[model samples]
Target: MDYFFAVVAPLAVVIIGGCTVRSVKIISEENEALVERLGKFHRKLESGLNFINPILDTVVLEDTLSERVLELKPSQAITKDNVSLIIDAVLYWRVIELELAYYKVQDIEEALRKLVLTTLRSEIGEMDLQKTFYSRKDINKAMLRELDDVTDRWGVKVTRVEVQEITPTPKVIEAMELKRAAEFKKQADILEAEGTVRAMELLSTAIKSQSNSKDILQFLVAQRYVEANQKLSESPNAKIVFMGSEPLGSSMGELLNNSTISPPESNGSNSKSK
Candidate 1:
């Protein structure tokens, strides 16, 4: 009887000790785990101390409930207008249902990456190159909507999406620059022509508003003469020749007549004489 008691006591101690180690579960804060009993989901273990039938229970998965960020790789896509562009994006998501997340998807991150890329290309294909740059926010919204729709079944929620970068091809950028320069040059030409027209209109109005247009015309010609001489003086290779002293109005008028640009004044006619 003494030998029987000694042997049974050691076996009982071993059995109790093994059960204690297997049944005890201590999960950290912000962490969760799924327990499966007999090859089927039984319950979820929350943070803190937990007890389980270790003989029939297994901790299937343990992960944090923290938000995660997934940055997508850059990819090339063509716009509706057939312009090629490189695009990259980021996704913010978190697991809300661990069971479905593990059961429904073979690989979570890879699945999300493919889905995001497909949605991105689909959205981009609907817009032109210019609209892509102008409507970045619209693209992000559409991507989030599409991603959420499909990812909902995976037990994850996409909180937000951001289109980080969009770049056109080098050839397209060069073409855009050239097109912009041409537009600027065209506007400058139009402004210059308008300015010339305005100046001519003002000169006509000034001349017609005066009682004696000939006096104003003579003054204008004299002003032009002095300006021409001033510009010529500034040139290093200019040759300024002076003729015999004569009234500027007479000399300039004769020069205009000789050049057939305008009729000259007659000196032989007296005042009020036809």
Candidate 2:
């Protein structure tokens, strides 16, 4: 009886242990899990061990899925005006639909890669190089919106799309740089001309105010005389000096004496003399 009881006790303990054994589902702090019961989705589960119908329930990994990244290769495209350009971009995205992401597409990575390439080419073809470079943020946003709208049904959300780089031909870049430089030079010239006009107007006002003012003229003349003397001192030749206003008056008087004053003769004068 004791031996039979020991054998039964060990067997009962093994059965209970097997029945109580639970599958541990480990989840990271940043993750969530979706559980299925007999091929039907039941509910989402948080981190730690939760009860499941042993053979009938299974946990689907929603967090283990890698974040999708789409890299668009450089492609040749024409602008609105028929100018050619090479453009490339990168897109960041992830699957929000665990069911659709796994079921809708055969290969999510391959599908996204093809979609990104096609979308990029189509979008870039409609824009010019100038618009492509200058309005890149707008372009990226537009692409993101379009991709998100299309991919949402497939359980994908486009988090971000960015224009990584744009390379214009060397000739086009050089032409643009030259055009900018010329515009800057033209503006500088216009400003310089305006300044010259302003300076001339101020000088004219000064001259008009000083007009016929003997004191001011005398002062200017004295200044000029001083400058002239200083310059003459540098010359090797001797300068002829005429002293003051007195010498100028005497010279003029001598010139007047040398000239004769002639009077007109008339018939009336002759009659009066007779």
Candidate 3:
């Protein structure tokens, strides 16, 4: 009888002590614990030592309260222009309410990833291929807003969404490059034509202001001759033609003569004075 009491008493004390210790849980600063009594939610366990009924209470869920990052796989989507593209993205989220996070969603990360992908596709579908490249901010903002609304019920806060990469097919890329080059060339041609028109307008004004059109005509003819000679000199086998300026000189003389021809009234006044 004495031996039985000594052995059984120590065993009972050890078992009871272990149960008493388990009644208190030590939760880390970055973590939260959910307590359920008889399969029903009783209270939440925050960071530090928490005391609860060992026999009646159970710690069902323990989740980290820190921010989490999720890198999404490349997903294929179509733009409003019907161009297909591959998009990659990243999401930032955190659990604000441990109980809701555990009970409201079966899989938080999976749900968040799918939400981000669907939202991305929807936003991309509303934009053209060109706009997708530059409208990343708008897309991110829209995704964050939509995700926050849905995830709020799950006690998940969507902090941010980032578009990592957008890749069009090889053929689409080539076509885009060609289109950009053509646009640049078109702008260059427009600027060149505008410069030519402006030059012509200025020349016309200068020619009208000058009394002796012969000087301006000679300068223009000489400049053209120099430019033509220079261009011909660039080729080794080029033939240089030295044409006379007599045709240009005769045309200028005729123009000057026509301008100097006075009215009949001025001619009659001069004749009467003489």
Candidate 4:
């Protein structure tokens, strides 16, 4: 009987000591724990020393208060224009309610990831390829709004959603580049034509406003001839030849005489006539 009593007393003391030590839990400042009694939710254990029945209560779920980042794998989605694109994103979230985070959703992170992917696909499907590139902020805001609303019940707050990369297929990218080039060329041509029209209008106005149109016309001809010679001189392959300016002079005289403005008679010819 003495041997039996000694053995049972030591075993009981050891069990009680173990239970006492286990009942006192020290939680970190940034962490939370979900306590359950007999597999049923009892209460949430906050940061610092928390006590619970060692046999009956268990800390089933433990999570951090710090932000968590989840990087999504690249997902393929089609734009409104039917252009296929691959997009990947990163999500920033934190557990707001430990009980709902554990009890409401079996896997909060996975559910949040799927929600983001679905929302992203839907948003991308609504926009054209060009708009998708420019409207990234709008898309992110929309995703955050939707995610916050849906994830609220799960006790997860989605702080931010960032689209890491949006890549169109190689073929689509090539096509887009070509299309942009064509559009740029078209705009350049239009601008050139508009400038030419404006220049012509200004020249016509200046010519009409002149009192001596013949003098203005002669000046314009000489300026153009000088410009042409300058361009020919600058050309690497151009062959410069010394040509007589007599023909040009005669053509200018003829053009001046045919003009509506009468040329002033020379003083020498007038004195000789007098």
lDDT of candidates 1 onward, in order: 0.87, 0.71, 0.88, 0.89
Index of the highest-lDDT prediction: 4
Sliding window of 10 residues with minimal summed lDDT for model 1: 256-265
Predictions: Cα RMSD each = 7.0, 13.9, 7.1, 8.3
> Can you rank all candidates by TM-score, best first?
1, 4, 3, 2
TM-score of each: 0.65, 0.50, 0.64, 0.64
Over the full model, what C-alpha lDDT does candidate 3 score relative to the true structure?
0.88
Clashing pairs in 1: none
lDDT of 4 by residue, 224-258 (tens): 88888888899899899745567887988897787
- State model 2's lDDT: 0.71
For lDDT, candidate 2 versus 4, the one ahead is 4
For 184-226, candidate 2 gives per-residue lDDT tens digits of 9999999999999999777545645653434343455567666
- Lowest-sum lDDT 10-residue window in model 3: 259-268
Candidate 3 contains a number of clashing pairs equal to 0
Give the clashing pairs for model 2.
none
